[model samples]
Structure formats: C-alpha cells, structure tokens
Target: MKKKLVMMLLAACVMVAGCGKTAVSDNFQNSDAKEQEEFQIEVESKIEQEKCFLCGDAEDSLMGYYSKKESIGIVHLNSLYVSETRVRDFDDDGNELFQQGGSSTMVNSFGEGYGSVAIHGNPDRGYTNIDVSVSDKDEVDFELLEDRLCQICLDTLADFYEDQINSGDNENNGCSGYCLIDFQTKELHRLSEPYSGYTMGDYYVKYDIWKEGGGSDWHRISVFIAYLPERVASGN
Candidate 1:
C-alpha cells in the first residue's frame, strides 16, 4: 500500500510539470502571433495613408503663375508694381520642400528707367531673388517695401509647409531636416541634421488653409503643389 501511494504521488507530480510546460509554450506562441498581427496592421495603415503626390505618380499636378505690369496706371503711380511670381511645392505628406516656378520684372518710378527690377527665384526654395534695381533717385527709400514683401513670402511658405505635413496623406515620411527660405536674400538653407521634435499622430490630423487676402476682397490661390515622392527624390 505504501509503495502504491508513493507511485501515485510521483505520477501526479509528473502530470503537473507537463501541464505547466504546455501552458508556457501556448502562452509564448500566442504572444508572438499577436505581435506579428500588430506589425502588419501598422504597415498597412502607412500604405493606405501615403499620398500619391509624394511619389510623383499622380494623374493630376498643381500649377501656379503670377504676373504684374503697368496695365492702366502711370509708371509713377505703380510704384509698388510686382511683375514677378514663383511657386513652391512640398510633398503632399510634407516631407519634401522646394520651389519650382519663378518670374521677373522692370520698373521705372521717376521717368528714369532703373537698371531692372528682377526677382530671381532660389533654385531650392522658390523664394524670389534680391529686389535688384538701380535707384533712380538717391532718396527713394525701398528698404521698407522690400522687407514687407519678403516677410509675406516667408510667412506664406511656412504656412504651406505646415499644412502639407498635417494633411493625413502619408506616414513614415516627413521633413527630415530644418528647411527654411530667406526671401530677403533669396537663400535656401537646409539642415544637415534631421528634424527632431513632436509630431501630430494619426488621431489628431487636421487640415489648414493658407490665404493672402482677407474677407470678401480675398482671392483663393492653391499654392500647394503635389508631386510624387519618387520624382521629388530624383530632384526633377
């Protein structure tokens, strides 16, 4: 009887050990499967949210142009005439930034034709060149006006950049470096290092509208240009 009891106790211990091992194995397998499922979901979500324009493979492209000339006013009255225009395009996902279109002009403020007022575009940022023109009168002050215009261009470009990044069009893509344009000097500068800061996640995505004028007197211009990531990557 004693021997049989001992044998029964041993068998019970064996069974418990076997059960524990099986439970552990099952738990590990389940955990692995769950992890794989989550990873796949993440990839699929990115793919779905990716913008076609970022890849430059789109059916439609955005284009813009601006021109100003002495339409009906005297040259002196048109002191603030802007005859040049340019457009900057960023990734629909907002990772890439660059300028494309540009314009130029000539102005005469006091019956004396200044050399030429040419607003050149930065090859990278699309910001206009230095307001270059010979001074017809030594006292004609243009610094203030030039400063104001440069500020406008900078503000417009910055707003456009933020809008594209916030649009829920792509994932795993963003402005890697600090991208900036100086309109006053017509310089394009990009950081050698990548951008490191807080970013808006999937749940809090929002759309932004950038405008130049206000109220009923405002004109809506879509300066947002869309291009595929591949094309933009190629620098085309």
Candidate 2:
C-alpha cells in the first residue's frame, strides 16, 4: 500500500509538468555545506520579504490559533475525490481497457496556512496527481517565493501523507477536490472555493491535480526533508 501511494504521487508530479506548469526545483540533493548555507540564506531572505504570505489568516478571526511568527509559510495537501471506483473494463482476451479506483486523502498542515487540493482520476491505475501551489491576489511576484518555498512545503506535506498512509488512515481515501485551508482556524474547507473578498492580508497556497500518469520522480518527495532548515526565526 505504501509503495502504491508513492507511485501515485510520483505519477501526479509528472502530470503537473505536462500541463505546462513547472514544479519548484531545489539543490538539496547535491548541495555541500556551503551550498546548503547559500540556499538557506536565499530561502530566508525571500521569507523575510513577505512573512505574512507564509502565515495564516490572523487578522480576520481571533478565536483560532494563528501564528505569523513561527513560520515563513504553511503547506496544505488537498484531498482527492473519486466518483468511480472498483470498476474495470477489459476485452475478451483480458487486455484491460480501463479501471477506476482511487484513495488519496488530504494531509494535515505542518503549520498555520491555507489552500486547496486537486486530482484528475482514480488510483487503480495510479493516475492521481496533486500540485501544491500559491497565489498572491496583490499581483506580486509570489511565484518566485513559491519556487523557493516549495522545497520546505513539500517536505512538510510528504511527512503528513506518509504518516497517514502508515497509520491506515488512508483506506478508501480518494483525491481531494477543490478546498480551502484555514490554518488560523485549523480547519479545512472541502469541496469549496475561496469566498469573494480581497484583502492585503489574505494569502493562499493551492495544491491541485495537474493530470494523471506514471512518472518515477522521487526527488519531489521526502528527498528534501533532511535539507530543510528550521522554520524562519520570525515572520516579517
């Protein structure tokens, strides 16, 4: 089951690429101590520029546990919802035509943050694809920040997914559809969209389904977990 999940995720990563959208790349795999330090400095500097972007919605509601000082950004993994499952088609010769099945759930956040998840198909063929993304309504070049932050964000997400799968919490889980992450409230808005409203303090990190395919790209998984330095000392 564990191996199955990994394959599904890796497949999704490839689909994300074919859609003309690029996943953020990192140098953690081959970086030496000096190179690692340089990467850290670059990450930290970007975090400093817009600390609030990485933070949850703290100004809107005061009832939940929100923190802008403890993290530079939060990562959220959306769940996948499969409408068809356990259905297979094949020719008389047993050549499989198509099969439908999926079980990918949303992983809890590592910190206070918010966003959605997306998936294209069932897990039977291991065609689940998920992309964790972000957007700044302020029209700022936040994609650059996303590129630098994805390394840590994916690390956080992989830990959550691995933990869930190992614990058997992933049984019958399908890809999470569009949803919202209220890290401030520690809540997930499933099968929903962001309400109409724009504020400078509002931020978003979206993880959606790019497409479906089998791609053996383990580099995007936990490979960077060991390279992740501590969270930013303080938010900007």
Candidate 3:
C-alpha cells in the first residue's frame, strides 16, 4: 500500500511539472506575439505619416526619396528625351582628333524655372562629361537651383538604370546599385557594386554654384553625379 501511494505522488509531481513547462511556453509565445503586433502598428503609423507629402498618382514618382521641406511638392522622375547634337574635335589643321561623338541636352521644366542636363560623350570616352544647369525666368535662388539640379540628376540616373534592366544587358547579373543623395551639401554619389565602403541606400548631391556675375539675374548651377556602372554608362 505504501508503494502504491508513493507511485501516485510521483505521477502527480510529473503532471504538475509538465503543466508548468507548458504554461511558461504559452506565456512566452503570447509575449512574442504582442511585441510583433506593436512593431507592425508602429510601421503602419510611419507609412501613414509619410503619405501626406508623397505623390501617389504619378507612376515615375520617386516615392522612396522623401523631402519634408515646405517648398518641395510631390516630385516626379522621368526619362530624358534629349536632343542630340553631333560634335567633332579637330586640330589646327582640320583633322579629326577623336571618333565622332555627340552632345545631348535634356531640359526639364521645374517650378517657375527650368533645368537642363547636357551629356557630352565620344566613342573612345563614353559620357566623358555631364553638365547640369538650372535657371529661373524671374529670379533664381540657391535653394531652387540646388533642388532642381539634384532632381534632374536623379531622374537621369534612374532612367538609365531602367533601360539597362529592360534590355536584359545588365552586367551586374541581378546585382543592385544604390544612389546616395545629400541635398544639404549638394552632392550625389553612386555605388555600383556591393560593399563599396560607403553605406548603401542614399543618394548624395554635390555641386558648386558659379554665379555668372554678382548682378546676374539667372543662376547657372553645375551638378556632379557619380556614374560608376560601365555597362549602362558606356551604352554597351
């Protein structure tokens, strides 16, 4: 009789221990689910706040690049429909110096102003130089010029990348490229390959403003945006 009583006690203890473990596990799972729910709510709130200034109608709108400035409205990015002008270099003796290249100009209309990007390239030196300039009809300020120039460069680069992806000629072979933009300093940098030292995911815009003259009414801005990918850059 004593042996049976001891056996019953042992069984009861085992059952209690098993139940304790299950209860602990359930508590842990509930805690995890609550944390996840909180995180999801936070993310949704952020997206909702961002929707205020975001452009939802345009297909080419750069929704990823957000600006909180009051002056900036819903920004759009579009492909360049540049007009090509043939350019040929000649020595003093009228001899061609390099292979025939062309200069292309793409002008975009901005708020109360206009911005243009001129690309000069040769077969030997593909896209040797890119000049970004902006001006306003009435009066242009540093803020307007800087913003317009950066936007133009971003649109151009994004258009180029889209072309490469659509052509199935991307040499990166599914590798991704990122652009870093800094509106404060007016710098734009591109990371063509993975792990290029600089943190990925931001496009920087860097440029110098050279006022034609102290009394000049218009602003002539120069933009420098890094283009590192050889395939898309060289038109290969």
Largest TM-score belongs to which candidate? 3
Order candidates by lDDT, high to low.
Answer: 3, 2, 1
Cα misplacement distance, residue 181 of candidate 1 (Å): 16
Kindly indicate the candidate among 2 and 3 with the higher lDDT.
3
Candidate 3 local distance difference test against the native? 0.31
Locate the minimum summed-lDDT window of 10 residues in model 2: 218-227
Against the unseen true structure, what C-alpha lDDT does each candidate score? 0.25, 0.27, 0.31
- For candidate 3, write residues 102-210 as lDDT tens digits: 4444444433444444544332332223344434332212232222233434343344344334445334311112233332222333322222234212222233444
Tell me how far candidate 1 lies from the true structure as C-alpha RMSD in angstroms. 24.3
**On TM-score, who's better, 1 or 3?**
3
lDDT of 2 by residue, 1-236 (tens): 01232212223334344454554444431232131111111122233222223232223332123231211112332211111111222333434454444444443322223323232333354223333332211111223334333334323333333343343422212222122333323333332121221211233223322223385211111100011234576877
Best by lDDT: 3
lDDT of 1 at 195: 26
Q: Look at candidate 3 and tell me the lDDT of residue 205.
A: 29
Q: Estimate, for each residue in 1-236, the C-alpha lDDT of model 1 and write its tens digit.
A: 00011112223334434464455554554444421111000001112212221112223312111111101011111133322222232343433344434344333332344222333333254333323222223122223222222333333333333333334322211221112222222222221112221112111111122223343321111111111123234556
Instruction: Please say which candidate is ahead in lDDT: 1 or 2.
Output: 2
